[model samples]
Target: MKKTLLTFAVVLAIASASNAQTKIPPNIEKLLQKNTCLACHKVDVKLIGPAYKDVAKKKYKPEQIVELIKKPVPSNWPGYIPMAALPNVPADEALTIAKWITTLK
Candidate 1:
């Protein structure tokens, strides 16, 4: 019975992880590419920027994430690799990206 339960748990974990692979919204995807945000960030894996999964875990309101993207939060990220302020990136685009990121699990 213990072995059976363990197998079931493993299967469940795999299923959940697979189901949580969120896609980038079309406009957000285009914005990321245009703004070069994709160079440092990915929808799943951690690159120079933390993964979208990590961002979603913060549970911050969508508005907060938008502000962070526009201004950056080096303290929250903490490192020699400080987040660059995306002053050139439009605020509306950042908010769209933020809303999409919140759907990541």
Candidate 2:
């Protein structure tokens, strides 16, 4: 029974991870590329920064995400290098990306 349960748990974990993959829409992908967000962050996996799904888990409002983009809080993310503030990203684009990020997972 224990072996069966363990196998089931592992399978469930894999399924959940696979399902969490983020699929950015073309517009959102364009915004991400324009802002260079993809350089440090990925939709599903951790790169130089935390994954978008992980950010979604934080439960921040879309506006909050925009604020963070403008003024990154290094303390919020330990171990990873601090994200540089992206003042160049337009407000509309930042909010759009924030909304898309919150939709993940």
Candidate 3:
């Protein structure tokens, strides 16, 4: 019984830690999925693209982020491959995603 309780506690702790690490609002998550942004980005870890947290650290204005989404600047991220422009994304959607990204720690 004691071993079972300890295992449960450990599982609970890991679940809570995972939840705390990444919590995108449902609306933002919907937008990200719709935009296919999740293909290369994560809330806290680098995927094919830099993590949202790292982008947030740059402290870009929301509008700037929107522009970057439409027209990515390769020089700003030296090691990464140049991000292709996503001009097809609607302005409002891009702004919404950009604002959410800036809120990340």
What is the Å distance of residue 12 in model 1 from its true position?
A: 12
How would you order the candidates by lDDT, starting with the best? Answer: 2, 3, 1
Q: Please write out the lDDT profile of model 1 over residues 1-105, one tens digit for every residue.
A: 999999999999998888575677777789889989899998778899988888899888889987887788788876538888887777787778788878777
**Candidate 3 lDDT by residue in tens digits, 15-76:** 88986868888999999999889998889888888989999999999999999999999898
Better of 1 and 2 by lDDT: 2
Off by over 4 Å in 1: 1-21
- Please give the lDDT score at residue 81 for candidate 1: 83
Model 2 TM-score on a 0 to 1 scale:
0.81
Which is the leading candidate under lDDT? Answer: 2
The residue ranges of model 3 lying beyond 4 angstroms of the native Cα positions read 1-20
Q: What is the C-alpha RMSD of each candidate to the true structure, in Å?
A: 3.4, 3.2, 4.1
TM-score of 3: 0.81
